[model samples]
Target: MANHPDQPAFPFRRPNPLRPPGEFERLRAHTPMTRVTTRLGDTSWLATRYEDIRSVLSDQRFGPHLHGGAMGWVGEARTGDSLFQDPPGHTRLRRLVSSAFTARRAEEMRPRVREIADSLARAMRDAPRPLDLAAWFGYPLPITVISELLGIPQEDRKQFRAWSDTFLAVSDETLAAAAQAWSDLNAYVVRLIADKRSGTGDDLLHALIAVRDEQEDRLSESELFMMAISLLVGGYATTANAIGIGALHLLHNGQLGALRADPSRVAPAVEEVLRQQAGGGEMRRVAREDVEVGGVAVKAGETVLIPLEAANRDPGQFADPLAFDIGRAPNPHLAFGHGIHFCLGAALARVELQEAFAALADAFPGMRLAVPAEEVGWSVRLLDEGPKGVPVTW
Candidate 1:
């Protein structure tokens, strides 16, 4: 792809594993809101500054819905995911899911999360030689928790993970695979919803189904299917990646010893990890109208890409942004994003991370990377970036 003179190419490469692309820093310093050519060859405004990114996300002028109310989804209109919806629709769907993801509800799951984490840690400790922490612990912990919460059968969880992997894959080469995954997941969710409708259970899916059946205009059948997919996608990939990346940060910076020494720091340490290890491609939004951002005029219909990783590291937002300090106070990072679109599963992710880290710290105090640091592979294919596998042993 040829780069325009005024626009740098989108998806800039990350030269350093610990920081965002050097180009992001350069862009922030010079042109905070410059044009960039997207992978799809569309020109979009790339927002890198902390304030600018927040404005773009918070402003109603920039919406997730594209022109003519059409979304990126393959099939019919009503079946579109809420992530791609705007205004009243987004508001309604968010309301339906928000009740289930309340802070109290998430807090109630902490003990259960700790139990799952402890079980994974024990398994990791007993495994022969080196084990991939991500495969053994990071991935399965969240999958199990979400599975139990959503009432998915234990036998079906692995297939869900595979579908999730494909859906979140970042490459053009994986487009067909992603589509197939979407079809498979959609069909499975439809069947799951039907099963739940037949007999209500204590699971969140059953509760949602009840709401759909009893409440008027609360949730449509299409929305129900998309909601289940959203919950699975939103609740799974990001948490799994965060766990893997957070583990790497702790191991690399000798923070594991600190965490083991004082497990009370696990919570704050998780926050620091969230801040430092926030890695993902830019978020996409289309301008609903002409808007001025960081003194640059964005015309209607123009796509805007907010680089969260860069915004989280802006020096204006955090002192010594590059340093990995767990105790950094007043940290308002955009790892979970900003504004109304802020992650609904933020509380749950925090609980899972806190418990997972605490359990790992307690279980494998002497853990070290089994492979050389440079040899550790990352998942370039996924929208969220993290170690493909963290091979480690005590």
Candidate 2:
């Protein structure tokens, strides 16, 4: 396989994630799918168009288990949570938690999520000037919600955060660190699983253990622990990114004032925010067979990186992709991805984002970026993307 074939160029680097060079757009327009060197040193097919992404995401030819027994790509496969599985494995795990992620279930959690959002906003109100909203609110709100739902002990949150940090710090860029973090997290989960065995609780962990014992299709010990890890880490990281980046987007676009004045707009605004700003750069999938996508033939075992941020802004799909209009109806963006791999926690994430945005709007209608937009930091190393630190003030 050629390492870096001649193709349309994109700003392909790990740093300066909040803003990539203009090359990505040029690449999408000129070459929808082409080989490019990633920060991890792997040359993968970068799919930038909307239809290509949808087709690849929905096609069963792209299997998650590309590397056989080991977790493929970002170690996410072995880390579990059904994100890496296909067919019976993914289907089964999805079924186990399907009930909890329903729209009705999320609707039920709205009040509670709002309460948490309010509490976070209240705390941020008293926060020192030029606050890091990410630390004070973004990272904790959905994390706390997930922890509460999973029945993780309140005191263990810090430990869980540490593990998650280590986990997120891994990528193709830090293969060694990623491997170590994966092992450490799996070991930690093994103990957590053992502790929860004594008696059941109302938490999801207890529910997971029940699956292990009662269900014939239950997960193995390693699978259960890793599944929990995936949920916790994925839950925390993605929501944190959305909250941080989404809030920043509102501030940048001067939407906070209008939304605060009229709270009815927060729901639709959240969808747009998620569509426009909330995402990591790309996700990895291997082409299981020779097939043409975006007019490019991808052979079996070839890799494809779906950059949601680029696609969300594709002109072919969105009329004015860069324009951040809260009332952008008919927004059929792939922010939550497409097909069966769609985010299972999408409902909960919407609830959390709506609550957080509404709370910020209510508590600090004047909230604005403490730093200039050009000065903000970005993390682009993982499956999700967001600012390094979102500084805000009211």
TM-score computed on alpha carbons, candidate 2: 0.92
lDDT of 2 by residue, 191-246 (tens): 88888888768888899898888874567766776678778887778888888878
**Any runs in candidate 1 off by more than 4 Å, and if so which?**
1-6, 65-83
Tell me how far the alpha carbon of residue 124 in candidate 1 is from the true structure, in angstroms, after superposition.
Answer: 0.6
Task: State in Å the error of residue 172, model 2.
Answer: 7.2
Looking at model 2, report the run of 10 residues with the lowest lDDT sum: 65-74
RMSD of 1: 2.6
lDDT of 2 at 74: 41
- Evaluated at residue 26, the lDDT of candidate 2 is 77
Clashing pairs in 1: none
Candidate 2 Cα errors over 4 Å, as ranges? 5-21, 65-82, 171-180
On lDDT, the candidate that comes out on top is 1
lDDT of each: 0.81, 0.77
